[model samples]
Target: MKISRTIHMTNSGRKHKTNKIKSIYNNMLAEFKRGEIGYSTIAILGQSCLGSIAVILLLMNDMPTMIKMVQLFLVTVFCMAFNGAVLAQLKSKITFDLLIATILLSACVIVTNLV
Candidate 1:
């Protein structure tokens, strides 16, 4: 009975943590959508520059062709999706999410290429 109680407590704790994280994520998305968490022009430019450098590094890396192609495809897709969101005037939250994804994906690619 004690073991079962401990397990139940652990499960409930996990659920609580999950709920907290989800709440935070939802609140942040709402703020972005409402333009409360603004992305300034400079921030956008900086993200773009980082993404471009990452792409350049990826292209110039000596990795296998197949890997390069896959990475390039990922980057292209993320970038295109972000651009599409902007062109279509989608919710700011969606655009912001895509922009963040592009930046994060680029950073990962850049780090992998550098290493």
Candidate 2:
């Protein structure tokens, strides 16, 4: 009986945690869709995601540092294109500051690695 009770509690606890995570994810998605978060925030976050993937790809290829930088730059540009398109679809204007910030960040990454 005690073993069965422990199993049931564990199952319920797992379900509770899963539901909580799902709720949080849904809320965040809703906010992004609603434009509650500004474009810069969204772009940075999107770029970060793409950048991580690019890093993983670069690692797997065992490429040179220069090549890795170039790949990262390309990934950053692709992320910008995607974010721009999404903002455009929502009729949101892309600002110069956001563009410059992302470009500078990408450049910094490449330049720092070159040193």
Candidate 3:
């Protein structure tokens, strides 16, 4: 039936989109590993600044104490992980991945605080 055909087409389209995103992500990771996209110093500083800002925002927010503590713990863990990556001199890809994750997590926290 036309409805079944449409559903199948939609599923196919979703798969295609997902594959495209994955391909793009992989390409970016490759480029980062090759030292073509990010700098270690900048990423380190960014992680530090963003982490501090996230902590400040979390503390200033009117959220419940338990929720605040949980978010703070996550932020601290992420920051520490990034620091550990630098201290351990891990590969560029791993360090960059952690930096990106830290930035994203901090951005989420900041946005949540503002909104």
Candidate 4:
């Protein structure tokens, strides 16, 4: 009788599944660090306006309360991440303060919804 060995491959196989995603995220982070002031400003402002509009629309829509809350949380997280990236790029004191204020306001809204 001869013994044979067979290797089974999983979904990830030999490479980590998240390597591509991790590389992309790292590249984006590096770009943000080396981005210009004007570019960072434009991104921050544009994203702020868009996020605000999205939150407003979600609030006014006929969605369930839980769904609206989840949407709000996701929107707030995106807004904060954008602001953080801009702040990291520009290293501006004003951007830092704005980020803090945005977080506080989001927390207040969430609290109100929960209560």
Candidate 5:
């Protein structure tokens, strides 16, 4: 709760971290209220999954659309990966959101590559 230790700064630093956590919690609650599963989570996981599917389709017959889909998926994967890395340094809801997205992306890439 309080995080009583002054590891970084004094009240100012602790206050910032506490605020960051609060913001994250609020964002999570807002997502729940809107009946949304956190946009970041959806984007990361969805794009990756789509990419994997596209790759599979490409391997099956190499359709033209598959190429476009793979390109789109790759873009999304890269964007989400960058966001995840940034969030890894932040103390906010985005961190969890990004982490989930990273996992989804990794899973999709691995599965699709195998396929």
Candidate 6:
């Protein structure tokens, strides 16, 4: 009696078996690093809208000037960080949208709080 052993004989068969898995993911990296896409424009737009509302509320409450000033500083810093994250992703460089967003948010917060 004789026995025969068969092996996979075609390149196409071997290639077909590996077609199930698509991408390779590295598990050692952290999420949202530099040059990372932090959030979409819609999300940032929403955040800005919320900030505007907060400023309006502060104005209605007649908050202290000192508090307003501090809030302004914090708002500026936060805006810079937020815009930097987006620009870093889009332009692949450490840029900031501070020119507009930061100033506008700070002014809004401070002006609203003062009133």
Predicted structure with the largest TM-score when compared to the true one: 3
Question: Model 1: per-residue lDDT, tens digit, 39-78?
Answer: 4344456667877888899999888899899998998788
Instruction: Output the lDDT of residue 27, model 6.
Output: 20
> How well does model 3 score by local distance difference test?
0.83
The candidates, ranked best first by TM-score, are 3, 1, 4, 6, 2, 5
Count of backbone collisions in candidate 4: 0
Mind giving the per-residue lDDT tens digits that candidate 5 earns over 1-115?
Answer: 7767756645754534458787886776566445434654565466556655645544565347766477547646665564655445444345555555555655655555456
| Model 5 ranges with Cα > 4 A deviation | 1-63, 66-71, 74-90
Cα-based lDDT for every prediction:
0.76, 0.57, 0.83, 0.65, 0.56, 0.52
| C-alpha RMSD by candidate, in order | 7.1, 10.7, 7.9, 10.3, 13.2, 12.2
TM-score of each: 0.66, 0.34, 0.72, 0.48, 0.30, 0.41
What is the C-alpha RMSD, rounded to one decimal, of candidate 3? 7.9
Q: For model 5, which pairs clash? A: none
Can you rank all candidates by lDDT, best first?
3, 1, 4, 2, 5, 6
Find the candidate with the highest lDDT and give its number: 3
Error of 2 at 49 (Å): 14
Worst 10 residues of 6 by lDDT: 23-32
* Regions more than 4 Å wrong, model 4: 1-35, 90-115
- Candidate 6 structure quality by residue, lDDT tens digits, 1-115: 6776877576764544333222121121122233234433643575566566655666466557888667756774666576556656554223233323554675666566566
Residue 93 C-alpha lDDT in model 3: 75
Task: Report the number of backbone clashes for model 2.
Answer: 0
TM-score of 6: 0.41
Candidate 2, residues 5-113: lDDT per residue as tens digits? 3433346445344587777756755555566447557666766664565456555665587877676666667556656755665433334334445555555554454
